[model samples]
Target chain A: MNKRELIRRTAIEIIAEEGYYNTKVQIIAEQAEIAVGTVYNYFSNKEEILNYIFKVEFDKRLDILKRLKVEAISFKEKLNLFLEEHFQELETNPATTSVLVQESQLPRKHSLKAVDDFINELPELLAEMIESAKKKKEIRDVNSSLIANAIFYTIRGMASKVVLNEHYNFDQTKEELMNLLWCGIKN
Target chain B: MNKRELIRRTAIEIIAEEGYYNTKVQIIAEQAEIAVGTVYNYFSNKEEILNYIFKVEFDKRLDILKRLKVEAISFKEKLNLFLEEHFQELETNPATTSVLVQESQLPRKHSLKAVDDFINELPELLAEMIESAKKKKEIRDVNSSLIANAIFYTIRGMASKVVLNEHYNFDQTKEELMNLLWCGIKN
Candidate 1:
């Protein structure tokens, strides 16, 4: 791994182990097996490191969505693929999931611009997919932005459950979520 | 307002103005025009006060739902009433909404039990409504808990948007949300 990736992975592990407030840059530097100054060279402060972690994860999702856009697949297929990948990402890295969920709840202080951009980007991508679906007649006419927000929040709620509830059956929950989104609660 | 109510309202205002971490019990006492000792006489500490803010707000919601249960209305009507009231509450008290949302995101160091109870109770109440709707054939049979959780998260997303975006039209958003929930997204 490059120095930046090395620092980010180390920061995630440390923040996950010790809550973000308790984590310090020095601790991350030690964990990454680098000098504190070297860590600073990569990230100005601890918050930047946290921001970078989110950016990296978000970028991965965005990349998948971008590729899915070119593939010969239905919007439902794209959404299902996205949800599966999202849940799988969290399931594999429970600690990163915890940090992401927890940090998001805190006040927006450090790297506010980066954080805001990342937050906006997710919904924007989802909205684009919804628009694509609408144009292709895969879905009924609706406010794509609102629907996108609803789907985004549902995914978030699922992720929180995955982290907070140890007994949470991810596969079952994912199946139920897909069924609910595709079919909804209408009789 | 009673002394308890006075303190609770004051705490909400203060916490909303300056986030939960920045808020101190003494500041709350001062704002309420009560002695710090008197504040403690009613509550243990700052966290309890924060918990009380959530409990008070949640209790109001629960009470409304309980009453809605006996009313001669369809399940859809009850759900709409609940969402309308929920959105109105946030619109009227944006500050308290801010405190509630921000504090919920923070690490659970204080009043974990109270926080957990509040979180669980909301989805539980929504689940109850879904169950009622299903039994009455007002809505199709689906997993009540999952549906309830989805509704709960959607409302949360809306609340966050209301706080973040000044131009957000509450009535329109509420209308769109009901329509989405009532009719599936399928073409």
Candidate 2:
């Protein structure tokens, strides 16, 4: 891997192992097998590294969601694919999931606005999905942004549960959850 | 107020205003008009103050929930009443909610095990509600603990959205969400 990429990956590993407060720049540099100055060359400070990690993870998740495709066009199929893809990614990367879920508990001394800005872009992306689903008569006609926010929170809630409830096996219930999302909790 | 009560209340006010890290023991003592050492007499340190505040808020919420009389009622009514109680408390004490939510994110340099323990008790309380709902034929006969976890997350997600989303109105969606929970998403 490139030097910059090595630094970033090492930062995530250290943060995961020792947490943000305990993991210093020097520690990360040593762990990454680079000079401390070299680490500072790429990133200004520790907070920046944390923010970069967060953005990368967030962007990666969104990219996965964006790349979700359906060869045969059915709204149900599309939605199921989306759910499966999202959950599978989360299940495989529990460390990333842990960080994402717990990151909010981190101090607000840094640029949360950047994260907020990234999240703001989601409603529009969801608007397109909602418009298509509406045309397909898959979901009820509602305010796209509102529905989008609900959908986002629902998935977020599910992820939070997976992280917090250690013994809660998500695999068995994954299909049921996707089905519930499509058909809803209605009888 | 007594010296201890004054310090505790002032701590909440300061922490709420300036956040935990910014709000120090000296500042809290100044706000409470108590001696700095007097604050120590009441609590060991800043961490103790936080634990005290959490215990106070935790008991307050549980007290409200405990007052809910569910005997001889249909499961639907029981569940509705539980949610109504929760909403009413959360709406009334916005400051406490902020503290409670943010406190969970604070660095665990102190004994925060109490907080997790409190959360651990939720499944038991929720499982009882779920069983009652099942007996009343109000919800699907799924695993009570699983359903409880889902309900817990659903409320937390909705609550977070209410806090973060400026355009989203919880009041308007409250009824619809309740209906969704009661009736599921099926047509």
**Highest TM-score among the candidates is held by which one?**
1
DockQ of 1: 0.38
Worst 10 residues of 2 chain B by lDDT: B178-187
* Residue B76 error, candidate 2, Å: 2.7
lDDT of 2 by residue, B1-187 (tens): 7887788788877787787878889999888887899999989888888888777766765664455535676666655776676666667776666666665457754436557655666655777777767676666656666655555656665665666667666664555456545544222
Q: What is candidate 2's lDDT per residue for A1-187, written digit by digit as tens?
A: 9877888788877777777778899999998888999998988898878777778867765665566432446666666777777778778876666666656557664445546655576555665776677766777655566555555656666667677776666664465455445554212
Q: For model 1, how does the per-residue alpha-carbon lDDT over B1-187 read when each residue is reduced to its tens digit?
A: 8999999999888888888778899898888889999999999987778778888888888888888877899887887898889888877888888886775456554435655775788888878878877887778777778677777777777677757766567787787687777664222
lDDT of 2 at A29: 92
Residue A128 in model 1: shift from native, Å?
2.7
DockQ scores of the candidates: 0.38, 0.32
Which pairs of residues have clashing backbones in candidate 2? A184-B185, A185-B184, A185-B185, A186-B184, A186-B185
Q: Candidate 2 lDDT (Cα, whole model)?
A: 0.67
- Tell me the lDDT of model 2 at A111: 42
Quick one: best lDDT, which candidate? 1
The ten-residue window of minimal lDDT in model 2 chain A covers A178-187
